[model samples]
Target: MYPFEITTPLTIDAAVQALQNEEAQPLAGGQTLIPTLKARLAMPEVLVSLTGIKELQSIAERDGQLCVGAGVTHANLAKQTAQYPALAALAVDIGDPAVRNRGTIGGSLANNDPAACYPAAALASAATIVTNARAIAADDYFLGMFETALDEGEIITEVRFPIPQAAYYAKFTQPASRFALVGVFVARFADAVRVAVTGASEEGVFRWLDAETALSQAFSAQALDGLTVPTEGMMDDIHGTPDYRAHLIAVLTKRAVIAAG
Candidate 1:
């Protein structure tokens, strides 16, 4: 790993200020960041650790939403988010025990790995991504693969998920990394049904509008009988081809919808 200065800030303001320095980056759980550093893919001059900030560690429910702190670990989230069983179940299968204990929800969302699971949940739930600067809707937050709306020095403080009437996440995991080769999250609200697919698109996590429209009209697996996602922009990696991922997207979406029911 590259030589860098590590600073643990006790407050959000302090952490933000520290990140303003040249080549300084926010360090949450360090799951993705640490691995990148070891590979010399990232060489920051300073690592501003957000783990010490107490305000980023609380999980609560308020006004019909589940407010999850940015620093909440996968393990903790799996245990605490019983109110949103689908989300908690997603967290429970994130990685192995050690990775689950170390990886934070904020880290996962910020990194926005194309194959990551949380992005699907956030998008389907229409969750709000809260940062030190402002709150961004999940629809606007994710731009593309490994991209987000966050600006320099901005840090994710919390995420607010509007609890859905019913929801489910179905993932086709890549055996080695356990990252989703294709995963789908389906959420049914009072007035709408949202379906988000991850691990399939090259454009990153995206809503399957066709599926959403069909499921919104009738929330059931049978509603998606002929619906299919095009392979035009799907991911084509050694793990799976674009056609395979596209096929999985349809299959998983049906599975998720059935499970949600």
Candidate 2:
């Protein structure tokens, strides 16, 4: 790691002010950022730790939604999955026990990793991202690979997921990294269905609208029998090809629907 000043701010205001420095970056679980520093991939002059901000570490119910603080670690979320089984299952399998202990939901979403699990759930559940500036709908939050709609020095306070009638998550992890080679999250409501796929697209996580429409009419694995996932813009890498990922998306979506039922 390069030389950098570490600032532990106790309040959101303090954290935001610290991030105003052009070279300062917010540090959460340090899962991705720390490694980047070690590899000299990133060299921010200041690391503003968000852990000390009390208001950013809460998990509670608010107005018919489950509000999860950005500072909540994956391990912490795993234990609470009984309330949100689909999300819990995804959290339990994130980067193993050690990584889970350190990775934060807010950090994961902010980083917007192409293969990250949280983005799938957030988008599938139609979750709301509450940031320091304003709330952003999940559909508008994720821009592209490792990108988001957050402005400079903006802080994500929490994420709010509305309770759904039924939901499930299915992930095909790359053996080495345990990151999703392709992950699907299916959230079904009384009137609408949402199917979000991650780790498959070149454009990052995106909703599979055709699958959603099919499932909305008949919520079952068989409902997707004739559906063909388009591969035009999917990621092609050493781990998987666009065709392979397109196949995985269908398989995982079916599995998730069956599991959700």
Candidate 3:
């Protein structure tokens, strides 16, 4: 890793101030950033560690929504988020024990890795991404591969997920990395249904509107019969082909719906 100064901030304001340096980067779980730094893929001059801030490590239900602190680790999320079973299940399956213990939801969403599991859940649940500057809707937060709508030096403080009537996340893992090769999150609401797809799209995580429309009418696996996602924009990598990922998108969506039921 490049020689850099690391700042441990005990509060959000201090962390935000530390990140004001143009070459400074926020360090949450370091699951992705550390590896990138070691490989010299990223060379930030300063690292503003957010873990020292106690306010960012909380998990609570507010009104009808689950308010999750960004610094909350995956293991803590999996254990503490029983109210949202689908989300807890997704957290439990994120990487392994070590990764779960070290990785933070804020870091995952901020990094916006196309294969990451949190984006699928956040998008499907229509959650809100609260940052130091403003609140961004999940639909507006994810821009593209490893990209987001966050401004420079903006810090994500919390994520607000509205409790769903029923929801499930189905992921087809790429065994070597444990990242989702093709993952689907299905959520049913009183007014509508939402289906989000990740790890399959070249453009990154996206809502499967066709499936959402179909599933909204009839929340069943059979409701997805004859439905197919175009392979044109699907990721084509050694682990899976574009066609294969597109196929898994459909299959997993069906499985998620069935399991959710």
Please report the candidate that would top lDDT against the real structure. Answer: 3
lDDT of each: 0.94, 0.93, 0.96
Candidate 3 residue lDDT tens string, 220-256? 9999999999999899989999999999999999999
lDDT of 3 at 14: 94
Worst 10 residues of 3 by lDDT: 1-10
Worst 10 residues of 2 by lDDT: 80-89
lDDT of 2 by residue, 122-156 (tens): 99999999998899999999999999999989989
Ranking by lDDT: 3, 1, 2
lDDT of 1 by residue, 12-114 (tens): 9999989889799999999889999999989999999998989999999999999999999999999999899999999999978899998999999999999
> What is the TM-score of each predicted model, taking all chains together?
0.99, 0.98, 0.99
Error of 1 at 93 (Å): 0.3
Alpha-carbon lDDT of model 1: 0.94
- Steric clash pairs (candidate 2): none
For all predictions, the C-alpha RMSD in Å is: 0.6, 0.9, 0.6
